[model samples]
Target: MAAGEVTLDPEIALFLREMRAEWAQHPPLESLGFPEQRAVCEAVRARWAEGGPRMARTIERVFDPGAGKLHVRVYLPDGAGDPAPALVYLHGGGFTLFSIDTHDRLMREYAAAGGFAVIGVDYPLSPEHKYPVALNRIEALMLWLRTHAAELGVDPARLAIGGDSAGANLSFATALRLRDRGEEGLVSAILSNYGYFSTTVSDEAEARFGGPGSIMDRAEAVSYYANYLTDIERERSDPLACPLLADLAALPPVLLVIPECDLLTEQSLVMDARLRAAGVAAEAIVYPGTTHSFLEAMSLAAVARQGIADGARFVAGCLSR
Candidate 1:
């Protein structure tokens, strides 16, 4: 057993075991072509869509042709008044796979939990769209949100952004870009779930969290980064590509949810420290006995439920201020 490898929660262990069984039968997602990989991802998501809690009063899909036909799903929770607070979300797929449909249930959960209109952005993928392309589209979406707040039932004054994994990376990157453009006030809070902020692995984090059983291993991380940024040397230090290396002053308050047994746990720890050092309010919580992408398994993981609740509280407080 590795030094950092701890016993998984009974349910979590069972969940991993089941996934491992499936992986043994099918080629790993990374080994397949993009279309096949996406199909597999959607298939997995379909199994979990057994009528989960639905609280949104209205859900609508809108298209922005300016962002290359980018699709955004808006979820307005029940009892939400006109001009409700909004959280612009990006779905996680390591910058390659997954879509709004794969993450629909999760976005709905956040909308119901936070009492805010959650907009899920279906941005372009990498190995095709590549670096900076998705960022530009997201920035356009932010601008569109500002201009169409009233029409969309969102409060222009109270806006936030967030996502998980690759989406979280985009969320932070978008906020940084907005700050550089003197539009930082567009967002009041950030919700980052098991995000990847740095391409380089910290030795401390590697020793503490890296292991065979971890959902995202070092090789997989390297592959994802490679696909997103073809020129690692040239793009590695770019703030938009790696927020951990960015200037962290006066940004929005951040709520980070870290999964203890995951390889990317260090990103959240270092991000929290950097934000605090820069006099920014950034709170992070580590869900013990959980692994990367555990939030998607909320129906089976109590820690995930708690993490979502914590996120809801953080967003509510930030928007109310």
Candidate 2:
């Protein structure tokens, strides 16, 4: 679809309108103070999550003793075999907000649909964890998972990594790091759902998706970046802080699910071009009429459901290949 032709799906638009109305009645999450914001995040998740499906098995709070007791949640789909394919999922919250619990329902959906185990990483957030901290932790987690895959009931060979928003950024960065370490073949695919990849916004993006009617405004974008990378110098130079600037060649096949009405659409487009230019196989699908974080409202959005299904199919295809 043409970028300019993008419009919000009626249902999604109504959802956004209702959300704005509610935020007006209550305080907007972005406008609220930090403590209140955190509390509201928890409340919002509880309200929207209809209790995810029952998995064949679920192990929560699994600790990686070698990495400061790093916690991860493992969700195994029903009828999974002895060495099921797996995906390491990172939760999106601009790198500073939300937790694995908030994203549990979506993870379960992906796990069930993709017929693979989903490992959700509860990495430390920013302002407390800062640049490269999350990246380093992700690398360590990858290593731990590789070493312990047999015990975890997953095949290390069929592993993939992905996330939405900041998590997507980390996914790309982690893949790049692994590539640099000559372990790029470990990743079978990448699932990036409307993820932000740069701290800097392009003029074309700003002209296309930024402004008054945008779901994620420029100010909010700046705030998220600031929270994640408080250090100006590092934000500019650290490849992990902005994977869009990293070497895109030699990475695994990537599936980028782009939302139609998000400022980050252009980021995905740019990355797609770079990946192709660098000889990396990449497929980018734009979900027409959707906005950023639409997957969070899967309970209310048909398009969101389709997007999740598409993601599952893409991952399954990658593993089969």
Pairs of residues clashing in candidate 2:
none
- Each model's lDDT comes to 0.82, 0.82
Could you tell me the lDDT of residue 179 within candidate 2? 85
| Per-candidate count of clashing residue pairs (backbone under 3 Å) | 0, 0
Give the per-residue Cα lDDT of candidate 1 at 130: 89
Instruction: Quote the lDDT for 67 in model 1.
Output: 64
* lDDT of prediction 2: 0.82
TM-score of 2: 0.92
Lowest summed-lDDT stretch of 10 residues in model 2?
1-10
